[model samples]
Target chain A: MAERRRSEATRQAILDAALELAGEVGYAKLSVEGIAARAGAGKQTIYRWWPSKGAVLLDALLAYTTGPSGRIDDVELPDTGDLSADLKAVLRATVEELNDPRLSAPMRALSTEILADPVLAADYADRLETPVRELKLRRLRRAVDAGEVSADADLDVVVDLLWGPLRTRWLYREGPLTKRYTDRVVDTVLNGIRRW
Target chain B: MAERRRSEATRQAILDAALELAGEVGYAKLSVEGIAARAGAGKQTIYRWWPSKGAVLLDALLAYTTGPSGRIDDVELPDTGDLSADLKAVLRATVEELNDPRLSAPMRALSTEILADPVLAADYADRLETPVRELKLRRLRRAVDAGEVSADADLDVVVDLLWGPLRTRWLYREGPLTKRYTDRVVDTVLNGIRRW
Candidate 1:
């Protein structure tokens, strides 16, 4: 029990250091040595647990959003029972999260890294995207039960319509990702997602 | 005039070499030296013309997709007097483009490279995204004039609705990108983009 407790603590420290350093230097300049030094853990310790810098950053992202438990399902979406209001709030919060320098830097790094590595991409989908997507769908499912959304609405399209634009702006820097933007997005897509 | 012609030919050869090498080895392992060697040009020659491998690949992408002139506006979208048919056809063609191994490899490389470099991302937007997006919106605007779409519909949202989901599938590899898939996207979003 003591050994397990110490291991968990070490893991948390590494993830925490990763987030800190990634934010400071951005992902392109992020180094495993820097993470180890910040965490006060050995390089071997980090290597033993994670496969690559991207893997470490991916876990850090998971832990940052969902806590150290690192379960993607643990990430929450608010359901005040109004689908429109709930979606707008969630999207606005995401805009704010992306605006946060500390968080966005690491998130961007992880996203770029995953683009080059197919193995890491699969791990990201399985560990992060798949579960979080299901959870978002769960909230939408609740809305469907409440008769706010069309029962026949394709769940995948609903998810993409609401969230994909956010990703595009984030990745491409196409436009300002603002509350107004997300709000407009929600307002526009609401016509598409909800029962007509 | 002869000197100008020679420079243009050299530039075209370098861009062609970048695409060929990128298709073979992907962007991560691609090097400027290898490209110079393949193009039968000096390393200094490549550096004199293009800033980096990504820049070369970006121009190569522009040329391959839109021909040697590399005018994003010149990349055409069909009208055929039907928004639904035009969009479905375009998306399905995009699906085919993404599936093409020669094209997809370099496109993915450029995308991943842009993620890591802010300057490159900005150039990508200005040189490729902005022009192509405007061209796409031009096609949609014709729909508005024809009374096929509502005048009040937000143009940005309309662009994102059709294109953003495709980007999501492309980047995340979340699902199989297929004609059936693009057709459904057109069918579903048609409700939101067009009138009730």
Candidate 2:
């Protein structure tokens, strides 16, 4: 138990150091040596636990967001039975998370770097995107099952269409990602785009 | 006129060569020397005409998309004034342009690189994003003026909301950017998400 505690503490230190360094230097310049020195752990410790710097950072991000719970464990779409309210609640939390100063730069840089290197992108998708996507899809499917969604609706399109505006707002930084905007987005996707 | 023709030819050659090499080697590997060699022009010719590689590529992308009319001159967003149809039409063209083999890979690499590097990112916004965004805004404004859209609506939000899905689709290779998808987006934005 003592050895396990030491190992866990060392792991957290590495992740904290990596997150700080990734934010400071951007992911391209983040190095294992620098991370090790910053964390006060041996370089071999990091290598033993994580396969790559990307993995370390990914794990860090997961831990940072999830708190004591493992990634994807505690987070769930609001299930108040009203889809709009539920979606807005979830998206509002996301807006806060995206704008969180602790997370904003490193996450953006990591995502940006992944885009440049296609190989890392797959890992990024698996580690980050897929879980979130699956969670959202599951919630939307529940809505569909409950008849909150149109019977003929395509869940995949529903997913893209649901998140598309929010994605645009965050990625482009072109407009405010206010609750009002999320509300409108939720409203627009649920109803058809045609005029009554 | 003869001397002017010579200058124009040289400019065209430089741009053509830059685009070709950007595609061939990826943006990071492309250089002024490669562009000059491919264009059969002197290095001084490139240096005299353009300030940087980003500028050269931007001009090339503009020319490729808009021809000699310049980036904003063509104004393809039809004022035929049926806002939904007009929006759909322009988006359909954009989908084709984005999917075109000639434009996809290098453009992706450049966008990816800019995401990581702040300096390159500013250039990208200046050379590509600003002009395009301005044009889209104008098109939306014209629609508002013509009574096709809500006069009091937050036009900026609308523009971001409209393009957000399409951009995500293209950038992430999320799904087929077909006419159907484009039409659905146009419909979604014009109408609200709420069920009547």
Candidate 3:
């Protein structure tokens, strides 16, 4: 029992060190050696638990964004019976997360890395995108059941429309990602999806 | 006149060489020296025309995509009376451009570089994004004038919605960027924006 507790503590320390170092030097320059030194843990400890620096960074980002839950699967889309309000709430949270100074640099670094490297992109999609996509799909399904959405509406396309603009604005920095913008997006999409 | 023509020819050769090298070795590994060697031009010639390798790559990409016109400002959005059809046609063309083999690598490399480097990002926005965005906004304004779209609709949000899904799908590699998908996105947005 004591050994397990110590192991968990070491893991947390490694993740904390990764977040700190990533923020300080950016992810491209961050190394496992630096993380180990910062955490005061052995290099073997990091290697035994994670396959690469990318993996450690991924975990650290998830932990930082999602908190102690540390699992993206734990993120549930809000469904308050009002589909528009629910979507705006979720998107508002997303805008906040995207704009957070502490998280933006690492997220941008990870996004750039994934785009440049195909192997990492595939791994990231499987581990991170798949679950988050599934969760959003479930919420859309609930909207359909509640008769808020047309039965024939393509939920996949709808989901993409809802989330895509935010990603574009964030990645391209084309415009302000304000709540007014997000709310307008939700209103336009939800109005389109709802049965007249 | 003869000297001016020769200078123009040499500039075109440099851009072509930069494109070819960027495709062959990927953008991160591509160097100006390699480009100069491939083009049979002196490094000084390249530096005289463009300040950085990123500038060369950007010019090469724009030249390739925009064809003989060679100016992004020359590309205009279709303003056919049928907004939905016009939107779909433009998006389908965009899809083809995005999926082209010769263009994809350099484009991805440029995107990664822009996201990682703020100076490059600003330069890219100024050179590429500004003109394209302005063109799209013009089309939306025309739609408003024609009574095809609601006068009060947020044209900025609508433009983002129309273009964002395609970009997100392409950049994220989330799903197939099919013509069917593009048509659906246009239909949904047009429906939402149509004055009732």
Indicate the residue-level lDDT of A132 in model 2: 82
Could you list the iRMS of every candidate?
4.9, 3.4, 5.0
> Which regions in candidate 3 have their CA more than 4 angstroms from the true location?
A65-69, A192-196, B192-196
**lDDT by residue for model 2 over A24-108, one digit each (tens)?**
8877789888999999999998898887888788888888877756578468777888988898788787778777757876787
In model 2, which runs have C-alpha deviations exceeding 4 angstroms? Answer: A175-184, A187-195, B117-120, B141-153, B191-193
| Residue pairs in collision within model 1 | none
Model 1 spans > 4 angstroms off: A1-4, A193-196, B1-7, B193-196
* Rank list by DockQ: 3, 2, 1
Candidate 3 residue lDDT tens string, A9-82 = 99999998887788788878989999999999999999999988778888887777667887877788998998
Give the chain B TM-score for each candidate: 0.94, 0.87, 0.92
**lDDT accuracy of residue A171 in candidate 2:** 63
Which whole-number lDDT from 0 to 100 does residue A109 have in model 1? Answer: 79
TM-score of 3: 0.94
Worst 10 residues of 1 chain B by lDDT: B187-196
Worst 10 residues of 2 chain B by lDDT: B187-196
B134-187: candidate 1 lDDT, tens digit per residue: 988898888888877777777777788889998878877889888887877776
User: TM-score ranking from best to worst?
Assistant: 3, 1, 2
